[model samples]
Target: MNVAEVMTTRVVCVDMDDRLTIVKDILDKAPFRHLLVTEDKQLQGIISDRDLLRCLSPFIGTRC
Candidate 1:
């Protein structure tokens, strides 16, 4: 199969300075489970649902 055949054209991206709350909110509503973290239009890293869960687990009740 070709890369284009299975690749997604649209993606959910968030800035490096974006808060975890924002990440959680986006992931909650998004169809996929991963988020692309960028800075200055450059790809920095990727965060998944599980990863976000782990990070947010520490501060459950209060605002992130």
Candidate 2:
């Protein structure tokens, strides 16, 4: 299936300047495993659940 077929259109996204707390809340409450970071309604990059977890590592703490 194409991404548009399975991907969530009502995506929970975060702006570039949004705080981590907001992103964390969306990650915790949303069903999706990845979030699309956007600016001016344009896609920037994707932040996956694993990426957030990796940020917890001491070696890469806050890397995300």
* Top-scoring candidate (lDDT): 1
Q: Give candidate 2 misplaced runs (Cα > 4 Å).
A: 1-5, 58-64
Candidate 1 ranges beyond 4 A from true positions: 58-64
- State, as a TM-score between 0 and 1, how close model 2 is to the true structure: 0.68
**Cα RMSDs of all predictions?**
5.6, 4.3
lDDT of 1 by residue, 1-64 (tens): 9999998778989999998999989888878889999999999999988888777586755598
Scored against the true structure, residue 5 in model 2 reaches a CA lDDT of 86
Q: Candidate 2: minimum summed lDDT over ten consecutive residues — where?
A: 55-64
Q: Compute the lDDT of residue 38 as modeled in candidate 1.
A: 100
TM-score of each: 0.81, 0.68
Predicted structure with the largest TM-score when compared to the true one: 1
